[model samples]
Target: MSRLLDEEGLPPGMLAPLDEDPGPARRLSRQKSAALVQAAVLAALDAPSPPPRSRRRHEWLMGGALLVVGAAAVATWHLSRRSDSLAPVETPVVAVPAVVEPVRPEPVVPAVDSERAEVAGVMRTGAEAGGDVERAEVAGVGVMRTGAEVGVARAEPDVAGVGMKQTTTGGTEVGVPRTTPDVAVPSPSAKLRGTEMLPSAPAPEDLLRRANGHRATGQWKAAEALYLRVIRTDPQAMSAYVARVASGSLRLEHLGDARGALRQYQEAQRGWPGGVLEEEASHGVTEALRALGDRDGEARALESFLARHPDSPHGVAARTRLREISGR
Candidate 1:
């Protein structure tokens, strides 16, 4: 094949190289290339390959976990701090019932001992005061007298023949029998029968409650009577003002007794002058007069109320009523 290639004018080496051994330079070059490829492969394996997508994702996940752990720790610490800051509430102690003991009776003194003690005290007092004290038997009973008493009795002449009896005890009464008494003693039964028990007066609050009950039950007469009684019983009391107003209202609305209502309103105004009920009483008076067809009286009452209490709670109503009654 080489002879044929030379005859065709081909390069003799190109044809001959194919059948020859490789040169040292070519072998060196191939070895160097193989070394470079091995180095590149080792570098790709050992020298930090571009961080893996999984590694970055793991870093992010780890960071998020660290943040979550930090937040949880902070939250736990904050909760613990808050719990420590709060004070513990103290519970109230209940009192136990005390044990009760039975009452003891007082000791009684003997009559003889009491009498002897009294006699001894009297004798001691007589001796200290330089007075003579003597005990003698008179009419089969023991008697005692002082020296001053004996002298006074001897100086005075006794008109009656009644004998005197003395007792050693100080508590014993000296009974002097009288021939006649001015006042007669009443028998026990007669005394007991003569004991007159007055009826108890009703309380103001009770009367008000009863009156309100009756009013609620539509018992106007009974309610009015109770209200009147409360007003009459305690006119100076605050409840009386309420009763008077209630009575006036009952008379005006339920009974249609305008004159009686007007009287009650007037009395309430007099009893509670410039008081909390004054405006109400004045208004009630005007309303009662209006109900009775007394236009001039209504007008006058309204004018008085408006003048006295221009800034009263019912001032507007009073002014309006006055205007209506005055035909203005």
Candidate 2:
């Protein structure tokens, strides 16, 4: 009777059967309920109760204890399930480090034309004889006899090409033209009436006038050489750099002097830091690199230009070229 009542969550008792004659539904007295339940249990066993009727209280306690034990077991199971969900998970890690590299400046190459060095003497001799010089002059310094000497040089084959001629003497012919003493070359010029000029000024000015004339006559080599002399004596003559680049280009293109001519332009760029020629000089380098079929060098130069001069008009052109090269 106790086990059956506990399974149904009810007290361990079965009251008297329905009283059809009752005026209202009323529960049976505790003693009557206990007796009924005991009677049923005793009948099932086919024997009387082993314990006295006082043990009926113990049946209620047994049912309550079983319920408490079931509730504790359910609570413990739920707590264990919740704890599993709260456990920490392990996280994976990656080891990555940032690296920096030092940037290097562009390399510098001297514009010394060794091939031209031999031909230069030949060219100077030709110029001295007023021979054909489509392109003339070196990047740094070159010479062409100036003044009425232009026509005279044209007739003189000896001065056509480059050669070491001693300044102290008329070339290797030592002690020919008498050497002037140091005191002979005066400091400040003595004013003649309202004008004053250095004695040697006549030579350079004459050479300048002659250089322009040669340039007009398409005597680039002659013009170039004269210009170099002027700039050599006067570093402020910025035009010298531009003229050299032009002369070098023509010579290299026409004279098969690719190496020497390229050097000339390269050297000119080093000194020409400003002006229209400077812009042209940059292009000249690109052109030279292309002429040499140095695609890698040309591409690198274009890339460098874009990186350094983002705002330049050429920057867009360079970027466009790069994209084309990249096949984009």
Winning candidate number (TM-score): 1
Candidate 2 lDDT, tens digit per residue, 13-36? 123233332223532333333444
Candidate 1, residues 154-244, lDDT tens digits: the string is: 0111122223221000000111112221123221222223233123444455556656657556787887777766555545567666777
Off by over 4 Å in 1: 1-199
Clashing pairs in 1: none
Looking at candidate 1, the ten consecutive residues that score lowest on lDDT are 166-175
- Best candidate (score: lDDT): 1
lDDT per model vs. reference: 0.52, 0.42
For model 1, state the Cα shift of residue 30 in Å. 99
